[model samples]
Target: SQTIHQWPATLVQPVGSPLSLECTVEGTSNPNLYWYRQAAGRGLQLLFYSVGIGQISSEVPQNLSASRPQDRQFILSSKKLLLSDSGFYLCAWTENYEQYFGPGTRLTVT
Candidate 1:
């Protein structure tokens, strides 16, 4: 069985602070990982996805970036935050085209 993990279930940050979001998958190997966002009144959107260590893809022009440091760990980062960047963040791991998502992180920027 595989499980996904995400840290800091909720966050409240100022508009200019740095941000780091982490997600890890257990019971799997070299799984494709992804970071997704769901803002208020909007649909879920893919922020980044990774097929392997050091391989990442970004889907949006927002201030967020992602990296895969290990085979099963993915991270999302930001140097400067914005109010519009606040949203519900999700981490997912895929196997055989099925995506299993971890509990999301709720970020609020003010």
Candidate 2:
């Protein structure tokens, strides 16, 4: 069975601080990976996606960036977080056109 994992289930950081969140999948290979963000009570927004190692695509213009350094590892980073960056971040992978999501990370920027 495939499983997705995300670290730092919840976070609180001051504005302008650096941020790093990680996501990984097990039991899957070359899956279509994606990163998404959801603001409080808002719909999910696609942030980044990768089809292969070192390949990344941005869905929206923002202060965040994503990297896929391995087949099953994805990382999201921000040089300096903005107050508006606070939200729920989700990592997902697609299999047979169906998407599976991780537990997600909730970030609060102060």
TM-score of each: 0.97, 0.99
Give the clashing pairs for model 2: none
- Tens digits of lDDT, candidate 1, 1-110: 89999988999999999999899999999899999999998989999999999999989887988999999999998999999999999999888878899999999999
Query: What is the total number of backbone clashes in candidate 1?
Result: 0
Off by over 4 Å in 2: none
Locate the minimum summed-lDDT window of 10 residues in model 1: 92-101
Error of 2 at 36 (Å): 0.4
Which ranges of candidate 1 are over 4 A from the true structure?
Answer: none
| lDDT values, one for every candidate | 0.93, 0.97
